[model samples]
Target chain A: MTETPAKPPARARIPLGQRETVAGYLFLLPNMIGFLIFTAFAVVASAAISLTSWDLLSDPEFVGFQNYIELLTDDPLFRTVLWNTFYFTFVSVPVSTALALGLALMFNTGLRAIPLFRAMYFLPVITATVVVALIWRWFFNPDFGILNYVLYELGVDSPPNWLATRTWAMPSVIILSVWKQVGYNMVIFLAGLQAIPTTLYEAASIDGAGRWQRFRNITLPLLTPTTFFVLVISIIGSLQVFDAVLVLTDGGPANATRTIVYHIWEEAFVFLEMGYAAAVAWILFIMVFLVTLLQWKLQKRWVHYEA
Target chain B: MTAHGMNRRRFVLTTAAAGGAAATVANDASASSGAVSSRFHAPAMIGQAQTTLTWAVPGNPDEIAVYESLAEEFMSANPDIAVTLDSEAADFEKFVTLVAAGTPPDIGFATLYNWPSFAERGIFLALDDYIAQDSYDLEDFYEQIITPYRYNGDTFGEGELYGLPKEIAIRAMYFNMDIFEAAGITEMPTPDDVWDWDRFIEMTQQTTIEEGGRTRQYGYVQDVRWTFWQIWAWSAGGDPVDNLYKPTMSTLDNPAVLEGYQVFTDFVTSLGTAPPAAVTADQGHSEMFAAGLAASYNNGRWMVPLFRESDFRWDVMPMPMKTQRAQTLSGSMFGICNGTDNPDEAWRFLSYVVGAEGQTRMTELGLLLPSRKSVAESDLFLNSAPPTNNRIFLDELEFAKPLPLTPIYPELEKVINDQTDLVLIGEKTAAEAVAEMHTQFNALLQGA
Candidate 1:
């Protein structure tokens, strides 16, 4: 009893509770400062710069809301840029999620080679986007590429020049994007799959449920949260696609594969229009914000939760 | 010690290495003065009040070594001044940021196309005062090449000189001797005979050998990255822009310009004699030529070092003719940053490197279409064999035109290429693409 009462006073010497709080904040100080300086400061600075007319060399001249107005009403290329971004997001996000879900479902079985197959699928997710894009460029080559060779062997006459033609260039980029992205989503989906109780599946199987029925009734209803998560992030990621566009086609074949982020980089670095680039960046930020908000709001309709 | 040594250190080396990089030789009894061989590893420090000038060295290890040697030599001459070589300043954005931050290198170099745009923003110090004071023969350099680097408050040429040309690159055609002979092309493209666009196309078509669907050997392949295709329009008396320095209109809509654009675009699209972007998609067109997959490749002297390593036999010739004759005149250049503290010291060093001796030493890099008239014409430049037609490079300078670079050059290039790419891919005709060019170019050129 004396020792038990003495424990409170003994702990008072070190002050673990208060010390932990201070130490936790102390440990986080470096990262917090970095985030505030590099990211938060940049974000606010760009928002201010969006209202100015500054080339890199000159002092920023305030232009109010004129840049946003110009982007919306004047710049013809902005329309193309937005359209291309939407096309990429809408196509790449859905295709990647669906393919990843399918991969998760197939590999969920307790097969001996599951780990091997998982690693093989996840290999591209870890490879550098630049290396992947460069290799994809070779594969996209119409004449000497393995892609065209395979197509030829399949008796498909006159395969399209994947990166050189306007119609096929965006699709080629989307294909590359989906391929690089699918593995990451699949791993996430696998985690979601593992969390689902096998007992529920077994009960459903005993109830004379078919493979399709159980997948629909129990698995799908439970997986809605994961699906929603995957959809939101994939959509956000697709809108900001830059490295692949830069390395693979360079927004070429007559600006066919030019995306919003790619245009922002070009305007800021290549054209030296810092203010204009910030305006475009703000536009992109708003777009991502609104899309994510819509998905978050709409999740109530399809997203299921358990008690 | 020699009593005259102290006085000789102050004697500036404003002259170009009229002979070689080591023009100072050992004539000076002072060992710290241009004794490159013995003092190259470390320039012997002699005098005090040492002013360190930072110079941006933007090249490979071999290039850095040469530039470092140049610095060592300069330091030996002016022992009072030390030079620091910074490779990071080589980046355009970083350099501009450093300038804006008010801590730019004393001397900086960038592609010639960037100088006018950079100068317009007052990024570089105007060297007119220095040139006048030194009675430095600006005439020692090619007038046409140097003229493009001049910038006033508004336009280029007829203004204060902004910088000096570092080296030059003039375009010529490279034909694989093996493929040409195999295709029965005995007569090389003669600068005198001056084959027309139609004749060039016919010759390429004859050499093109296709098997079933695959092109076994491409007749010709040109990289679409550069503005080298302007050779077609230029030879036909068609100007892509009204003036090279301050272009207000995109004259691609002109009859002759369209004729040039159409003929060049037709080679890949309608003609199919030259490799399309699809054929050369995996490899650069230059690499494709060096590999003997193409009969001829059109480029400047920059490709010489790469082509030299190839096992195949190849030679050079001037490009085909239209109504007029012309080729490209574009290269990199060096300038003193506006923020430089030691302008006098920087100029002495800059002038020497771009001068005859410096250019002769640079030719060791194997691609100095030397900026100095003396160096370009000297036996030092002419002796590099295998090209055989080196004389044509100098002769073409009469018609060499720099690209119409302006404050909006990077944007202008993207605008022009975006539309031209459409034409080349057969998505649109020359007239259609030019219509787009006119719309975009007016916005860019006049916007400035």
Candidate 2:
């Protein structure tokens, strides 16, 4: 009667979707916690630090907008670095993206050895930046560099000191960066090109469209989304260019190649002006954010979406 | 609540309780073992718990090995004070970050130029108390080497000792003997020879060779570093700053300083005694000298190890004087971190490294001049060199002045260097660059 025929215990009923949601959140907890702790918190902390005068070794003092004022109004080096960053971003992004698109188009042909050629082109992209920078430094050397040697053989008696002269230093850095980065962007472009429906190209060709016309009408418009993505990411990356400048010229030969990131690093770590560095970093962030927003607004003009 | 919900809650509570019990048991087990061990050796371990000290050093692989062995010897001597060597490969920025992070190594090797900044910021612990308490023989170290580590009364090289001397880096003229002989120079300047700036320039011009509308051989290679320029300015009886310890303004406008600055630039732009700034920018001065393309290069004693591998016969001579003979003294030093919990242990390690033993090891390595007078004077340094005139470094110490040791020295150096580059590359005149430098330097000083 234990025996009264005890009914089986009622199980708590949970909706399938609710359980799935709980499980999903549980699964995401680790990564969410890590991102919050490391990235988000660090960013917020740095923002707060921007309003203070923290030398890292000593106690932080609230300096309000002094760092910002000094950076904007008084610091000539900051201006130079900002200009250099802008110059690098404006020059490198467009040139590299165009070059990448061109390379992608060339390699997109169904050749049997296409993989090998792609790998060969991508080798510099995979190589360490420092190693690449060092190699290029030697190549750009006016006396013993291979670049100058080739220039000399080609009847140019005096090749400019590529990394030394202010006029050439930024361009030299741009060239090296483009060469190293074009392969990466090319891979992205290749993926974008592959995703384009072959029907459109075929239709264009059926209409007696030439290669250039088909590319201009079909390929470029369809690839705009990828191009926009590449542009935004490239601009952000180029603005933060530090490693090549550091390894190649050390912002040297009179601070010609010194970019914003390099200046921030020097201010933060070298000069121990953490607050100033934080201020510079925030300024960079604001610039990047505004630029991205502008790009979003401008994307309506160029970026096309396939229905 | 549903029966299943109650069961689930009970199950969770039971699991948590079990986990807590298991954790307690594990913790107790460890605690029991720890207690037993402590009780067994409590008499011996009363007040001598092990202290692990971290030492950060910046050096190449070879130098790191030397430092490791020094640390090893130190640990062996002091068993209670364990040491961990952190090699940074000469990244000063990383070292500063460590200090800023407040987890700085107990002892850190830093550049003498950075000493004043660290001292002023209270990053480096003042060693005067430790020295007085230990009765440490401060006299053993060369005054010039230790001078950079001193900061008192708002002046460097005059007050409390913040760091012990690690090396004596005195710049001297390293000339290629073969190049001089090939140029038909019979008389070579010795350390004892009082060669003036004019005589040095004459010798440089005599050795310079031009062929096929190109300078095949450069007479001298001047380093582009601010320190080398400082030596030139000092030799000309001009200085970048009026005060050695507390620099306030640029003295580059001084007549002698301007003359020295002009002469240095003329070596590249006008005289062609040395390669233009463009060529040197492509190639290092030491590299050019080692390649025998340059007859002479003025650099520190650290060049010995690099030049020893060269095929050419090279020797050191005193820097040519203008108004007076002057050389810039610079080197790395080890200081205890103020935030270190183990100051005594740190000082013990520091003293061991900067003491006679460490100096001897450095001397044997031939990578640096010994900071200790006895070690520098010993045959170990004098005999262990490719440049036979090793004594020139020691002799020059009498006239070697420490670099301006303001907290803003790096900024000041940047201003001077940038303006000087313009002059060297023929973009600006000496007066114009110096005037610009003065303006910039005063602004920086005021800000500091």
Candidate 3:
């Protein structure tokens, strides 16, 4: 042992860059493993389970594409829910996007306490969907609600029974969703508005352009890329709407507010039809995918990258 | 019966009902005597070989505290078996996750909402063997209350026993005397007071008041819950389904059911009496009633503790009757898990919780209508009333029907509501809604 001690150990060399990369990966190893298991693996498992009949309590029985077929052809609720999801997307995306843009323009005037105003506008986006829904639910109450009281004062004989009728239920849920979502979109639009070159506005004003004309000619064109991005994301987000409908109407007043995701939850948790829920989830994924793809395809015609 | 049991903690010593299932409870009869029955309660095992039981029940903090105190009392009596509370056990998703992971609590909970279906899925252990071995006195519980827990593969109440009912939620019409007097009605409901549907409607109309296109006072405020709606269908002499358990057809199209559905739907859409469904979306019917906005409210005993703080004088009354009287029964129960490694020990805990001692403790809080007849009829409940007619809860149990429970109940609930919502919105007649319900219900039933 004493003779062997004379021979010192040889040091293995590793490049600093490679060592850093290895250390970085090691730091991420735990989270990466977690993500792979919980997100990636679960997603794949869900896709496979979509082909089986599982009740969560029993062993899954493989049924090939039967779940998909049932949902597409035989399940009437599926069609109504899918149509409801699209209706929500088409209506909510534009309304929230336009409202967000309007807020961005109003707040971009270098007003005092602009951050405070922006924060106030974005408050609902960060608030719990359930808490806001409960408060809005009070506002929409047909009996003793402020909304009805105002309608009565305005001499409208009858205010629509919000969240209680086939026609008004979805709109009530839509209004709440728009209220919740507009804040987030407004922040993004505010960023887009600030990024526009101030010189363009100055030059246009010097050319005797009025405020409206300046916005129409210079600001609108320059903001098209941002608008396109907002549209794509808002459309995708709108298609996946769940929490508002859940807390507000619970896909009810005759499934009027029932969206694709609420239906998936009902199938999986409430009905214990996990396989059917997975199939519904997959269908929702496809719809969101196709709609986003279409939006991306259409963006090239209107999206402007120039300042 | 033992004379010494009279001095035991179970103060109610009413003679047990005469029935085939009547039994001689050992420890209960000799509770104060120097003896122990359960293995863990044996004198030799005092502070020795121990087993801990996890009891999962869904409850708010206050309710869980009630359970926890009882659990503490149980553990002190049986030092060898420590009982722990898992309040999260009440959530269905969490319950499923626990079961899936093979870590289900020794004791589990189920409601009429999912009890039968969960039993069918084998999530719980059968209790007949345990009951027979222990000779447990189930005759103390109402037959109808216990019937719902007896599942025979295809139907409940026909085969093997599966649970010990904790309590039943049987709702009755609670009338506010102040509103009734203001409406110029001097009649208060007697215990035997059973109003016909027409009489009930007349009273409701009289109670309703409107000012400036707004309802100043609602005649009656009933929850739009499908379970409540089903009472209208049943009390109108409509079966709603050929079979109560796992019904394969919808009798919602029956003329009587359609009649019940129309009258109830019209209460909101056309009558201008009850507020629109949106009122409930924003505020519960009970809250509205409690706030003195409604003359009468329909609810369960659980509301008593909350409603006691109300300013108005209110009393529970018998529900309106049509061709027959009907009320809805929804209940929760506890049973041993099938995966439990210690079934005997689990049974010891379950039998104790559902025993007379435990139910009496829970009911003392004015939050339960115990399945045990003695507890329900005792001074603890029947006499602890501003209702003055608290017996209505007890009497109405005679006419109560269990909420329709099928393996596909959640779907059936949606199927019924989807169509009924149309009726409530004036978009469809009861007949049309029933037609739609028939198609959807049959499909779900056959699929299940």
Candidate 4:
């Protein structure tokens, strides 16, 4: 026993200060509760309902994957909605993000009245979605509309019926959505741009780097975190785009603008097929989740953070 | 009888009127006492305390004034119950969202068509108890007006009374006098004067005017979903909904309906007498007519003020018939919500709405035909300005058919609009569109 005691027992250590841990946990509580309420439990409940069949009035009857099987194999409307949503997401996100970043860069310069220009650019972000949709609808109007009128003056023949024509309807909505949302993302990008230390750019410039080289090495790399954030958020948002479509198109011109979320709404509330709609909602959530996860996984290669 | 006995009988009748099918709420006399009874006559008893109850309505500024006046009258009668009328005014769509959201106002003005959706959601209360207890008269409400409230022949809510029909719009046509004169059509289109398919087109063509090489004014304008086409569909003997909850599009694909569609499209496009694609182009033909751009417009009686305010002189007539004379019955109803904490208060408000006093007051506003058949026959609505021929709407009440009552109307409407728009824009033929519509509508129905 004396010989074993010679090998000195190691003392168990306790952290003296809990300020960092407490602050971290305190900050985390809000998100944890929010996720539990809005996302986690919702997912579970919705998934359970998805496996069953129910309208709002009747109690749910468990159908055991019948809805999913039908959604995957049989439902023609589902395919159309999936296509529309994918088309919208694929087209809108990049165009809007690039435009926002460009605008942010333009406003972030050391120019006079930058704040005024920023405010003007952010006007659409602050305006109500319904108002934006209405104004855009009028602008895109065929006969008395300012859009077609301008095109007529420019000597272009046969301007498309923006809301009424199938070919142009989604494009029209996409344009409206980008215009409405770009201002919000631009503000975020501007904040990210401002946070980039000037020293890096100066160092790059001194090392025989041209303007393009300096930007390539410094600005883009430094802005990756912000870009990643915007990408994730924008993707999530575009998947759920409803108000503009509801106001402007009502999923018209042969259901071209009928996104997945719109289909869910139409199915659940309008058609009163609650169980099938719950299935649709769960499917949408999974799709959005996977897409976000994929982006997160990809971010390891592209996104760089200092700390 | 003693004054107390008379009041007791009055309370019994009111309860009967409020309770729909299975209630004898006259026995709930004790419940009506206490807080409910006090709130019911709070204004008369308390002499003014100023409590505001929310009211929802539709239409623009002037129409809002009518509600404001109604609110003022209700407040004046009940000084304790202050009222605030919150108007949606823009379109029926927002009202749907609000009601569906489950936080519907204390008092709301909504079309009866929307009541089924609300009732199915268990959001509305059965007013039968209130009616029976209050001794309100049920017979005053026209049978046709209260039809929508009945689900499986049971009134909306737990009892008979859910909503009272405040305003109704049986389909009517507005004819331009100048166009009629120019067309050499001396006889006005009337309920008695049923025009066949060819004559209707001929009359429309005769009235069409061309100026500056462009079609300035069309002979007629009608939308695919609203007033005129609905009448056409009815006249061709097609019911969109059967007795069962099935959509009857493909089942009733008579050639006459297609022929009617052809006639409508040819008039607008091939004949060049009407604005091309006008049916799919505008929200309603009344707007076109109001702008002095169309000869005749088929719409509801609500368009009277639009006509009156317009520079053109217009008069309304019964919608022209093809096979059997018919007009689509369109109207609104009032219902009490089951979740309402103040059913007695709501019953009191509804009593005034359905009573002769309220119906007469609404009639005087000249915005709608009152749901009471007696009110329609009265000089009150008929003698009003805008020259509403109240008799034509009332006379056609027998021929008035309600649209398909299904919870799936919004879906059905979308499919119909999409298909019809395709046809109007020359993307599909009438037969093709009808077939497509039948398929999609059935899929929705079966899916439901």
The numbered model that scores best in DockQ is 3
Looking at model 1, residue A99 earns an lDDT score of: 98
Full-model lDDT, candidate 1: 0.78
Relative to the unseen true structure, what is the C-alpha lDDT of residue B97 in candidate 3, on a scale of 0 to 100? 67
Interface RMSD of each: 9.9, 14.8, 10.9, 11.8
In angstroms, give how far residue B28 of model 1 lies from its true place: 37
Residue B226, model 1: Cα distance from true site in angstroms: 6.6
Error of model 3, residue A142, in angstroms: 2.1
Error of 2 at A276 (Å): 1.8
For residues A1-307, what per-residue lDDT tens digits would candidate 3 score against the true structure? Answer: 3555443333236666887898899999999999999999989988999999988888889999999999989887888998898888889989999999999999998768998999999999997676677779889998778888898889888888888888888888889889999999999988999999899889988899999999888888888988888888888888888878877787887888889999898888777888999998888788888888888898788788873
Model 3, docking class: acceptable
Chain B TM-score for each model?
0.87, 0.87, 0.88, 0.80
Clashes of 1: 1
Candidate 3 lDDT by residue in tens digits, B109-167: 87777776688789999998888998989999988878888888888677887888888
Q: Model 1: what TM-score? A: 0.88
Q: Give the per-residue lDDT of model 2 (tens digit) for B356-410.
A: 8877876776778888888888888888867788889989889888767887777
Model 2 CAPRI quality: acceptable
Residues A39-136, candidate 4, lDDT per residue (tens digit)?
Answer: 89977888888888876544568999898888889888899999999899889999999999999988888888988988888899887676566567
Residue-wise lDDT of candidate 2 within A85-131, one digit each (tens)? 99999999999999999999999989999999999889999977766
lDDT of each: 0.78, 0.79, 0.78, 0.67
Name the 10 consecutive residues with the lowest summed lDDT in model 2 chain B. Answer: B1-10
TM-score of each: 0.88, 0.89, 0.89, 0.77
